[model samples]
Target chain A: MRIGELARRSGVSVRALRYYEEQSLLDADRTPGGQRDYPDGAVDRVQLIQQLYAAGLSSRTIVELLPCVSTGTATQSMFDRLLTERDRIGVRMDELAQAKAKLDRVIEQVLAAGLTRDGATGSAPVGS
Target chain B: MRIGELARRSGVSVRALRYYEEQSLLDADRTPGGQRDYPDGAVDRVQLIQQLYAAGLSSRTIVELLPCVSTGTATQSMFDRLLTERDRIGVRMDELAQAKAKLDRVIEQVLAAGLTRDGATGSAPVGS
Candidate 1:
């Protein structure tokens, strides 16, 4: 498939696909006319890349992990590093959960305050 | 205190402090020598800005939300927007959790394989 089709199928932008190629996270073959041609498996590859990126892995780390993921021949050091990264993600998730709780508290306060103001002024409730 | 002191107290870099000022997420008074001087409250304000940023709010949204956080005077639209942003963070948290789980599974498989390899080849266990 062409880059456009890959982007559409992968739900990633063409520019991002190009960037993945630049980062060596994805590969494409050149056609006789010098246009980029992707294999059928490119869609799944792109999705996996997106998943790793969403996991907060840097391009360098993703590049290292991709080969190991496919081959299952990673060195001990790679596994150790991956474990560290996983722990970091765990910490980030906890922080995000805390932040979300804080936001919920603030949202509750705002809604409660709005309700009181509306009651006092006889105004219609917000978003009504 | 000066910008340097604010940065030190906030544990944010000086360049980032200037960036917050540029983004209008922070403010500073100027000394006669034109150095940026921050009030005592600036530490708390910078911490708040950091919290909002960690919640994945953009600088623009932070600017909109800060006044409400401090003064409790947000409009209904702003409140609605904040709720939406909070929900977005919730979704992101779920995604990160799933990603972490996936990483955990892969890490387990890698470790199991390494153990098998060590047993077969009489190699020392990885990281031992």
Candidate 2:
């Protein structure tokens, strides 16, 4: 398939697809006529890239992970390494959860203060 | 405290502190000598900004949330709005968790495939 098809199916923009190729996150073969040719698995690959991008992974990180995902291999040491990587992800998940909690707290604090301000002032300002 | 002190205490760089101020995420008063003077809670605010940045929130988002957080007010409707904001944070947390899970799966797949390759080939290549 062409780039357009991959982008459309993956819900990623054409510009992002081109950027991913430039960043080495995606690869496409060149035909004799100079058109890009992609295999059937390209759609899934693009989808995966989109997911990684949305997850806030850098393009470099995605490029490093793509091969391991595509091949699916694990020696003894590799299995241990994968476990470590999984643990790192767990840490990041915790960090994100913490941030979310902080945000919630901040919002609650603000709402409470806003109410107090209005009650004491007897009228809320336009901006408030 | 000085920028260096703020940076050390907050675990954010002096450059980042300047950047944050330029981005309006942090505000500082000036002394008669024209140096920046931070209030007592500046460190906490800076830490909050760093947390938000690490959680993948943009500077713009942090700026928008700052006023509400600093004031700490809530009317009756404000509490409901705060709840909604918390829900949005919850959604973002879920998305980040999902991304981390996907990364773990990809890593696991890669490690398994690598082991299979080594087993079948009797020896793994340099790149593998």
Candidate 3:
């Protein structure tokens, strides 16, 4: 399929597809006229790449792991690396949760403080 | 306080504090020799700004919200805006968690498929 078709099917832009190719995250064979042509599995591969990106994996890491996913044969060290990546994602998730909880607490405090001030000070001075 | 003292107390850099002032996220009154001097609550305010940043809010958003936080009195619309921001953070956290789960599933699939391949194919070829 042409680049446009592949991009449309994958829900990625033509420019992004080209960038992906440049990044070696996606590849397509050149046609006789020099246009790029993709095989049947190209769309799925792009989807997998997008999934990896959303999963907090860098393009560098995804490139290294792509072979394992495709070949279905990874070494013991590869498994160790995957486990390490999983743990790193967990750590980031925890940080994000902590940040969220901090914000929640701040909002709650603001609400309670505003209520008490309104009761004591008889309506806070409003600004535009 | 001097910039260094505030930096040490707030756990932000002198360069970053200057940058924050430039970005209008922070301000310090000029001293006799034109050096910056911060009031007592400046450290707490800087910590609050850092927390806001970690909550995924931009400097611009924090700038707009700072008055509300400092004045200790926000209008009803300001409260609405705060709630909206909180909801947005919640959505992003959900997306991050979903992405982590997708990665977890991919890792699991890779492990299971690798085990099956090793059992049936009898020692898969390892790549460097």
For all candidates, state DockQ relative to the true structure: 0.38, 0.48, 0.34
lDDT of 2 at A84: 60
lDDT of each: 0.80, 0.70, 0.75
Model 3: per-residue Cα lDDT over B1-128, one tens digit each: 99999999999999989988988988889988999999989998898888778767888888867765665556666666677877877776676677667657667776665543333444454333
Model 1 lDDT on a 0 to 1 scale: 0.80
Name the candidate that leads on TM-score. 1
- Global fold similarity of model 1 (TM-score): 0.82
Q: Which portions of model 2 miss their true places by more than 4 Å?
A: A74-88, A109-128, B74-88, B107-128
Q: A1-128 in candidate 2: lDDT tens per residue?
A: 88788878888888988898899988899989987888998888888877666666677766755655566655555556446655665766677788778767766556444454434534453354
Q: Sorted on DockQ, highest at the top, how do the candidates line up?
A: 2, 1, 3
Winner on lDDT between 1 and 2 is 1
Clashes of each: 0, 23, 0
TM-score for chain A, candidates 1 onward in order? 0.83, 0.68, 0.76
Give candidate 3's error at residue B61 in angstroms: 1.7
Q: Which ten residues in a row have the lowest lDDT in candidate 3 chain A?
A: A115-124
Candidate 3 Cα outliers beyond 4 Å, as residue runs: A71-73, A76-81, A106-128, B70-72, B109-128
Q: List the residue pairs that clash in candidate 3.
A: none
Task: Give the CAPRI class of candidate 3.
Answer: acceptable
Which model scores highest in DockQ? 2
